[model samples]
Target: MPRNLPLFIAFRLLFNARYYYPIFAVIQLDYGLTLPQFAILNTIWAVSIVLLEVPSGALADRIGRKRMVVIAAVLMVAEMALLAFVPLGSNSIVFWAWVLNRILSGAAEAAASGADEALAYDSIPKEERETVWPRVLSRLMHLTSITFVFVMLVGAAVYDPELVNRVLDWLGSDLVLAKETVLRFPIYLTLLHAVAAVAVTLSMREPPLETECGGEASLWSGILAAGRWIVHTPAVCGLILGALVHDSVLRLFTVTASEYYRLIGIPVAWFGVIGAVFAGLGLLVPRLAEGLVRTGTPRNNFRIVSLISLVGLAGVSLAIPLWGVVVAMSFRFAFGLLNYFTSHYLNAAVDSRHRATVLSFRGLALNLGFGILTLFYGGLLRVLRDGNPVEGGNDPAYRESLFWMPAIFVVLWIGWWYHQHRRVHEARP
Candidate 1:
């Protein structure tokens, strides 16, 4: 594993999240932003990624995945730098800076999405593909979970107002403890993380090209081929679309989770603990999901995972107690493997020559759905909270808006199921 450059790089890259992701909403709120405002910022991020996903992906396919990954790392540094400079309070300058930060972060994410996975996939030895790839991927997930849990806990500890205030007093510093100061601590940590990520990305070697298409293809040609492939392949389209819905809802839920925690009476200080617990649960999910796949099939596994996600969303909508939130969030364990499974399926179905472009299409679909959902969710908050979006997460109207999410998943599930069923029947002699 140590010698596997791609896998090792991925594992190290996961630790680049020194900032506490679970408390991101709280950080925005501390900056004097409202829920709808934060949602809009996230929508902007999603929109940016959606718009760039395919073009960047096709370019990676045309060029090389490793180079794009290095570019993404640089973007990450820029994003963090922007966020770190965002002013203490809500103002035009602060808001726009944060918005720019989101855009940069989104671009970084889009750039790396398909390229990183493709690089890792192509790096593995062909003989060890079936057995070793999943194990390596699983270990990567575990590494991410562990790295995130540790980072979140440490960041949260530093971001804790009471803890920082006490230390400030003990140090006899003239600086008084402030919300902005505490919140900025995590952002500062990200600067170091970004530098490390850039270093790691720079050291990564691109795996040998395995595509049989000979020389590099043009971006337009790759895009055209990818578009046609999606249209022509029913299973690929269904799988990507289904994943789009599932992932979008889950992503929104995640972005707003800290707000939900606050609404349910949990303090910002406890968010890190809760996030760590959720990450721990995530560590167990893929293994459990694989066991289910062994007993059943990937089709059944998808249904079960989707059902569990629906249940989790419903639970989030209704949860009032801290324990309820914890239990509700724990259900995301099922989601840990959904994308890996979907990506595997998509990678298998697409030609290697256009793999990154098609994967980018999947990213574009997911981001587009998420951007639209963010707008709708923000609209719901505006309506339900009487324009006081700060309290929207606690609003019954917000919970009610989420009730429809399960139905969306159901519809996508049925569509995917029908597509798979039809394909199977057509294959019958």
Candidate 2:
């Protein structure tokens, strides 16, 4: 493996995801799909990932992380290619193509989920692993935020009709070709990002690991062992529960945030501006949370950060003005801390042989939470939107629907974490 394999992995992640995610909700709406329809699509993606997450993790541990990542990158390219070619709207063929694309995307997500982290952890020198791993995670977060800011600006610009028309005119495109180009440009751009990620993944090598990395056992046996470990391990189970609860609301917020901005009176074109601002603030989070990561127990960190996140979610759900929304969103700075500490804690608890498999258990829990929410929420959103149109930032039903339930979930999650924390400490010596 090259000395800079981590850098290459970072490069692939930096390019592979940012371009599409910032504009994802917008793309779905532009496709003439309602929120509920989009939620169903998300459910499909979650279901696909749920089915494959553990198996793929075990496969990565058995075969190699690099191979799994390469496979993921190829799947991503195929997914984007499907999206790029399919015309927008509720046409039967386009809808089915989008579904297929989401299924492939889910598979790609599962393949890469645990393998990247496991590979990165092993790649570090043993003597420096403790100190270096946090820094690597922090840098990765910072770089990812920076990439997000760049792509938000670029994606928003390209998706702007005026700019697209300007570019078409500069290229001397006929009116018909220009219209066609504008319609397809975003997907085409995303396809390029996917191809680049594949190239970058191909350039990297898997880090070496112990011979018994996935255990000298059958794949099913490996998975069973990992399941047993998760059930028996307090730290692992607690972390997974905490992550599922906290991330469920966060995931819902992410899916609807662009639309949330519109509901709060911010123009759609300015969504990128808000994203850039949030991403900039998000860059500072790992540094701000470093004290907790280095000095506090995982339970204590979760207690503190989960409280802060709960407050933010409440404000996001209740805030009435654009400035209020921006401030409320900024309150979510603790998100990165929650993410970092959970992964770090879980990694420390699990052994190397079953690390990927156990990590996939966490992914499974998350998808189950996400899928359930999407199904229940999708139907409700379908009803709310159909009855009341969103305009002039006064669609209380739609806006409330997005925030109220998630807020309730966060509150309940906070209580659950507090109980778990108390139980863990009480049981200690």
Candidate 3:
């Protein structure tokens, strides 16, 4: 296997996904998205995944893995350009343009998903491929978190949060005055995506494989085969379902933690500190996963870690609002910690041939779950926000940005469902 392929994948994700999210959030703010509205946009991406995911997986295995990735990279660049160049103001035209970009992104994402895995699987010999895939994925995730944490820190540092407040204080200029800075946040983002596209184009490689991998089955067939595999292979399915539950919580909390803190009276400047803390703690996750591996019981360890995650999530949700976010954040580290081991579990599940496709399915599940949750969440926030329009509903604040009333509901709902699922699944005959 070529080492460059792994490096390329990491860089692609780092620049493509990691950087663009924060940028998207800022642009949506400029365009008239409320927190709930952003969730709606996220839901669109989620729904698109549901539509394209299985089909794309078949496309990768049938057509060519590397080709799809290249296409996705190109689409990513176009998407950023659309966001940057599109004129500001609201109306169906502007809103739908952004939505079109997201849908394109979703389709690109679907194509890219299976292709990269197929490419990576093809690059290595069968035995070595499975082991390498997880490590590659983990490194990519670590790079993404590391990159975003720093970007946010820098963005926070340069932009004065009080820009809005000062204008409000002097001009009594309610909001139109503060809009320019929020909109410009995308400029920095567009630049980042440009750099990311270059990195992907320059670095990505398609390695050859020994096995046949999967094939160009019909989209529906691919979907059905995937479903059958899990149904017949319950243990395999159990762990995957466990992972979905585990991952969604991880994404949701990480996405919104900073915003929740800000809302609870933590200052914007201090938000960087919270992010920094998350990045610093993230360093520990790999080591924790390593420790679990050393114990010689990855399966047992993952189950234990899932429970640990539940407790941590439950603790933060129930405690933070009551005690304040600073106190809640104190318990937040557990999610990051559990994530490392979860990665270990994912690595254990399959061999190279289906790595990307199966993993893409997992990605599909996680994203859809998030999108669905966000959709419901948006409704909840509207009820809670009493229908106030958002600065950017289509942005990051929707994901990790928080509303306490809705959050409490999410915490309870997720916790209850996780428990019920865990109970039923674990008792499987």
Candidate 4:
């Protein structure tokens, strides 16, 4: 019911709903960067987040969450500005400019990861949190879904010169936007959102921290304390572990969704529409997530997500013509459910002093898991390519990876479940 809660929701929407997300790769490539350079930039971005994620959370805990949020917003603006105005040629300067942009973007992501959630969650009255938090999350999910759908549609439309020129023609305007000009449109829109993020984050009221430490803790000390806490806290540890098991694989699938779509007979032109349809799932997914949270225990929820993930992975591996899209879409539900369950359980279990740090650990674990999976996938592709030189094994490698994902997930989930179960049993004395 506090002002910070709504502001937090608004800040998340603005910070995350980038218009260029639908055409992220295309925009980078259109800027004269090769695919290899693009991949390197992405790697830099990931490394930046991994390196800064936990430290930023500790800093947020040490300083103020609002300050970190504001920093993230500012960085968002700078990153987008780089893309919007950087030189077009494929020169070393342009590449370095993008590298700096990626670093700033990753830092922004790291700074915001746990700080924003901690700020908003702490703003709620303690007594009301049990009932109110779920509703807050559900509302956020719904709004984010709607925003992403709009961004996807409009972002993709504006990126295409033909689409923009046709609309201009219909309006009796002589302005014919070139691809170079239109390519920056999404970045410009995202810059506007970044500016809004700064405003919203600045307006947020910092909630009082309830420190468990004796006094102000150093960054290293805070990180160590949080790490130890997670090691000692079975519920929190289990929740994060379970989330990692599901989140990493689903995220990998999401990253490669376009490729999967192409292999399944979906045209490249319809990718934006498909993305919009995927985003639309947010409309109904939050409701289902909330219902499951209300009715199921953490164990039951984990099992449900696991089952959905397994089925979705197996079905997608079959690549059953166009209908496989349905199976692929199922991962969205797993993703939504896993995130909701993890957030709810982790927030309820962690203390305020280390809340953000613990959440950062969650982010860190998920990212590391994804990074490891990506490496394994890359290796799988390489092996497939080496084995068969005729077709380069691109499609087969992808399908083989997909086929293995379900089995891998199953093994990891069972291991995690058993480990948690054993820990619980041993602690019962």
Each prediction's RMSD over C-alphas, in Å, is 3.0, 3.0, 6.1, 2.9
Candidate order (lDDT): 4, 1, 2, 3
**Model 2 C-alpha lDDT per residue in residues 1-429, reported as the tens digit of each score:** 335446544644544545545567777766666566688899999999999999998888888887887888788889988877776545676678878988998998899878767776777777777777777777777876777677777776676677767777888986534434554566777788778777777777676656554454667788888898787677677789888887776777777777777777787667777777777777888887777777887768877877777667766777576875664564447667777887777876777777777888898889878888878778777677776876654655667685665455756586766867776887799
- Kindly list the per-residue Cα lDDT of model 3 for residues 120-141, writing each as its tens digit: 6466666776577556655755
- Per-prediction TM-score: 0.89, 0.90, 0.76, 0.90
After superposition, candidate 3 runs with Cα above 4 Å error: 16-27, 91-94, 129-142, 158-182, 198-202, 209-222, 296-299, 315-343, 385-429
Clashes counted in candidate 4 amount to 0
Between the candidate structures 1 and 3, which one is better when assessed by TM-score? 1
* CA lDDT scores, all candidates in order: 0.75, 0.74, 0.58, 0.83
In model 2, what are the clashing residue pairs, if there are any? none
Best by lDDT: 4
Error of 1 at 176 (Å): 4.4
TM-score-wise, the better of 3 and 4 is 4
